[model samples]
Target: MCQWLASNPNELHLVNRMDEVGSSKSVNFDGARKMALKQIEEFLLSFSDPHIFSEAATSSAPATLAQVVEAVRIPEAGNLICSAAAIGKYVSMLQNPSSLLRACAAFAFVQFTLPGGQHAMHHAGLLQNAGASPVLRASAEAATARIESKMYARIVLRNLEHLQSSPSTQF
Candidate 1:
């Protein structure tokens, strides 16, 4: 299943449906779930470009990446932090001409800022930059609020303020 998923990342929706059905008490899909998660991690790490999350080349990629973010276990958080941070860089995609692409990029940033989102602090700085679009700014605001970490929130707020005061800044 993992090999198949790795070869066909776009088919993650099927696995998602399987997981939902397997969640019942009568089912024992623990092993399969674990294997799928491990495969997700491996697939992410092996992919040459972490920008896939931002690119949203396929209609399902954003949701699939969201599942990947949710599947990240605590023990391996450190190992995947860099990848999360890389994905966060795509927050700039919020400024894209296409609204659908912008929305997808915003969704990716929101996932990166969720609980257990390693390296979110690093991503906050990018969100605060002048290049960030209004969509990115709003998403960053939501992220900082959702994180509920005073220190991180403070940093993001400060950056937001800086960006707001600099009218000459370009997106």
Candidate 2:
């Protein structure tokens, strides 16, 4: 059911929305958005910091990342996540020693700026400004990267390319 919803463009926005609604407090949408994005950004950045956790204790990191990936599939989340700081953090993950972390960052980019996603252009602009494309291109072209990671990087690059040529996308 979750997979089906995420695959469907009509339902994609609700993956994050449903989670938010269930956990939502009595706060305005803007405030709630800020809080949620802040938490998500912190969680993602933590992965890039080796000092934050001992490797032996992060066994469930993949499972936790899967949930985070699902949680930010909405356009609103994309808008919030395109901030320079957030994008830079993600880029650092892209450059992490762990190939798994790099793959996860690429996957997050795919979800965050899905081609038809309302904020894709803005996210693309920020990503480009943060110099993510070179990193992504390297990831995609690297023979050493796992096939899955390479493909996710390719997908994100493609989405950004598509958005760049899009007449509606303004700098």
TM-scores, in order shown? 0.31, 0.54
RMSD of each: 15.6, 13.5
Error of 1 at 84 (Å): 11
lDDT of 1 by residue, 1-171 (tens): 223322332333334445568875577676875676565445434432335333332323435444334343233332233233334335433443333333334433443344334444544445554344455446434432222111222223444454445554343
lDDT per model, in order? 0.40, 0.59
| Candidate 2: clashing pairs of residues | none
Which residue runs of candidate 2 sit more than 4 Å off their true CA positions?
1-80
The lDDT of model 1 is 0.40
Model 1 regions lying over 4 Å from their true place: 1-79, 82-89, 130-133, 137-171
| Winner by lDDT | 2
| Counted clashes in each candidate structure | 0, 0
TM-score of 2: 0.54
